[model samples]
Target: MREDLTEQLSPAQIIERAEMSKAFRDVFALAGGKRVLFWMLEQCAIYTDAYTGENNSTNYALGLQSAGRKLIAKLDEIDPQFYPELLLAMKEIREADKAAAKSLAEKLEPEDDADIA
Candidate 1:
């Protein structure tokens, strides 16, 4: 099954694929997809840290929050009516993640010496 999926395409098929890819890129360029991709990458970093028990997820989330604010500022400069709601949504998400991180940190903290003794 894996071999079937890994099979190489013919030259014509490859050309068709390349053309389709170019078309997709053109559409994404017109739709501000780079901003969306950056947002997704930041989100992935934050969640990856959380799931892997890394200590830096909070920092990553904070960086994302900063980026979101910058993006909103840029949007405001370009057009005030363009997706202001998305900025608010991203802010809410960052706040929720911060709360969750705080809760997790509390749970993972070492016990006091008195309790251990």
Candidate 2:
């Protein structure tokens, strides 16, 4: 009979391992499990700061493009289906943020003199 190693870990321990482990490929493999995938999706869904009302999608994308490249690669190896879906979701958030920022900029722009005549 095989004993489950993860079963021996407390919730905090598991989270700590996930966040701090140097073996990210192994961690990503574990995270690719169905339940863990849902958890990761939930975390990735937070593309903005709720209290600050700040859009962080661009930052997230940059991180993924740079510092997170290894994580992305691991994700691709672990769960190929999720990689494109994650990119699509982030892209949607970024486009929405851009549109909102443009609308706000237009609103804040001074009216033309012709309009005041």
Query: TM-score for each prediction?
Result: 0.34, 0.38
Scored by lDDT, model 1 comes in at 0.57
lDDT of each: 0.57, 0.57
Number of backbone-clashing residue pairs for each candidate, in the order shown: 0, 0
Off by over 4 Å in 2: 1-69
lDDT of candidate 1 over 30-112, digit per residue (tens): 43454463475466453243333555866666676666566555544434644454445556667787999999999999878
Kindly state the number of residue pairs that clash in model 2.
Answer: 0
| Per-residue C-alpha lDDT of model 2 across residues 19-115, encoded as one tens digit per residue | 6544544443442443354345445543333343345856665443453455555666545765676555556556787999999999999989897
Q: On a 0 to 100 scale, what is the lDDT of residue 64 in model 1? A: 68
- Write down the lDDT that model 2 would get: 0.57
